[model samples]
Target: MQSRPSPVPFPAASAFPKALSWVLVACLGAGLGIVALRPGQAIPAEDTPMEAVAVVPATVTALGALEPEGETLGIAVPSSAQGSRVEQLKVAQGDSVEAGQVLAVLDSYEVRRAAAVRAEQDLRVAEAQLAQVEAGAKNGAIIAQQAEIQRLNADQQARIASQEALVNRLVAEENNAAVELGRYSKLYDEGAISALERDSRQLTLEAAQQNRQQAAAELVRLQSTESPQLLAAQATLAQIAEVRPVDVALAQATVDRAQAGLQQALVDLNQTVVRSPRSGVVLDILAQAGERVDAGGNLLELGQLTQMAVRTEVYESDLQRVAVGQPVQVSSAALPQVLQGQVVRLGWKVQPQSIITTDPSATIDARVVEVQVALDEPSSAIAQRFTNLQVTVEIDTQ
Candidate 1:
């Protein structure tokens, strides 16, 4: 009874509040340290270690695709005397064709056209020969030669005048190109256009200047050769006695030979079927069945799809970072996995990005050089399914 009365005098102070007080103080200190420490470092009391990776080298990625080694071959139909229509498109796009297989056909009008051209040329030659004979009979060989020389001189003068006009036009074009190039340069600096566009404008200017120079050279050539040639011909003819029957006979022989050539041309015109030059898949049909195209107009394009190469465009600014033989990884949407390749070639020229992404504001004129990647065998098998297929290429520049 006495012990119990003594124990009731003191209420046991709860150690919980004191422990909580110490805990709060410790938390405050720790929080302060954490807030005041290096930005991303772990807590001082933490047991887990931080992990990191060492990154080195770099890579460049570009969009491009598989092009044939020799590029696509273009087939065309010759323009005839009369315009020819495409009678048939025998092979459609993506058709596999053999060498000499007909890809398209032109109407028979081309045959008639070839004959007409030959005839016109023969008629002109005959008329000249007759005039030579008549002039010789009435006057002399010297007079005939003089007349011919005058005619040649007139023709040369007309050519010179025409070339001079061309030169003038080319110069004006060159000047305009220069102005445009300067304008493009300014805009590029201001970010109004892509670097590719600026470079393309520069190319146009250079081509214009080159054309002007060529025209000027042609004009000089005609002028330099015309008078001397005519004078020499006149001097030579003055020494001849006459335009004889033998000369007329020789001229007739020449006409006969030309007529033979005309026959051959006519035969070719009948066989106006456009054929593939090699065994390959047709990539494009540039001409329609009913369209009429002149000689050298593109009818269709063909290429061997078995051997494939990825063509990527690298930007001019980043071109310095790329080199031949760099390891590349090629990927296409058609394939389930990435394919390996090597940088077989680096482009000497830069051009615009040809395969644009879905971005509407993509720079179509971005000047980039075409880099070709020879694909690995396994990758090529997949690429063979698609010709001119777009792919992304990553070049490791390590």
Candidate 2:
């Protein structure tokens, strides 16, 4: 039945249309294979064609780990109140120290010498005053007065003995004249003597009595006029006693003045010894031994390493985010470990613009604020880890 159908042939133009359809199908398969093997070709997720949308790429620049910039100032040694010379240095750079430790000493010779001289003068003056107070009077004056009193007493005794001898002689003469007068009277009564002899005997007895009365008056005068040497000596003794107490008081006052001077000198000498005011680590040494320094001169630099702090500079735009008691994270290029800190203070005024500048044209005239942060844990290990290290700090605004 099919051979019979072949007898009826088709038109050539119709065959051309069938060949064209096959060729078109093969070309479509080849185009699909080429598209599947192409690299970086993406297919849309959706079945429908999507409209084109315009997009802008964001401009991003990376900073150094994006940490806050910290600015620290280097300081030199501070001044000391004590004006002592550098006799000895107990610590050096990078050496640790304690509170109230002796740092150096000064020359104390001048002060000690002054004190000793004052003490010696005080002792000599005090001893001299004491001796003067103890001595009542001059020995020579006392001896002269005693000798005069003794001479006057001896003269009075000699006068009394001579008067007694004269009285005895006068009495014996009177008795002899009385006996002769009696014999003359008896002879006159017996008519063996004349009247003139009896009269002469009576006159002789009266003369003897007058002489005895004069001798007695002379003796009474001598007894009445007494020597004044004892009274003079008593007055001198009273005067000496009165002045002795005053002399003693004056001596005591001199001694007190000398003692006060000595004490002041000693105090000045003690001030020459220099010592540390507080405990800390030595940062630098400014002066050396035998160097003449002035008053309040710089000696050494010291700081408490156990208590560390971080200082950061915040830009004017970021100043609002910084405040007291805010948390911060600190990192240093020299140290691998990170540290935690808290903000302790915020600057009241903005800092000068020239401090944080790279180039003159790149510098912004806006002033930056300063912030101080206190570390949580400060130790020797932490100090060694961050010694002379440039640090970075990050603060949270929220």
- For all predicted structures, in order, the TM-scores are 0.48, 0.51
Best by TM-score: 2
Note the clash tally of each candidate.
6, 0
Model 1 TM-score relative to the real fold = 0.48
lDDT of 1 at 361: 86
With a 3 Å backbone cut-off (N, CA, C), the pairs that clash in candidate 2 are none
lDDT string for model 2 (1-398, tens) is 45544576677776898989999999999999778875876566587877879963221110112121232222212243244456656667777767767655555546566776877787788877767776755677667666766776787778887888888888888898899889999999999988998989989988997897788778777667754764566566566545566777787788778777778766665555455666666666777776544655666766666667665666666676567887777765565577777778887887654333344685566566767767776423474425444456777555
Candidate 2, residue 368: lDDT: 69
Please report, in order, the local distance difference test score of every candidate based on alpha carbons.
Answer: 0.80, 0.64
Number of the predicted model whose lDDT against the real structure is largest: 1
Candidate 2 local distance difference test against the native: 0.64
Model 1 lDDT per residue over 1-398, tens place = 45544444554579678878999999999999778989886665568676789975499888886777677788767544225678888998888999888877777746567676877688678767766664554446558777888887898899999999999999999999999999999999999999999999999999999999999999999888857677887776764636677777877777677677767766666557776779998888888988887765787888888778887887777778888889999887787789888888888776667777676887777878888888878777777767677788899998
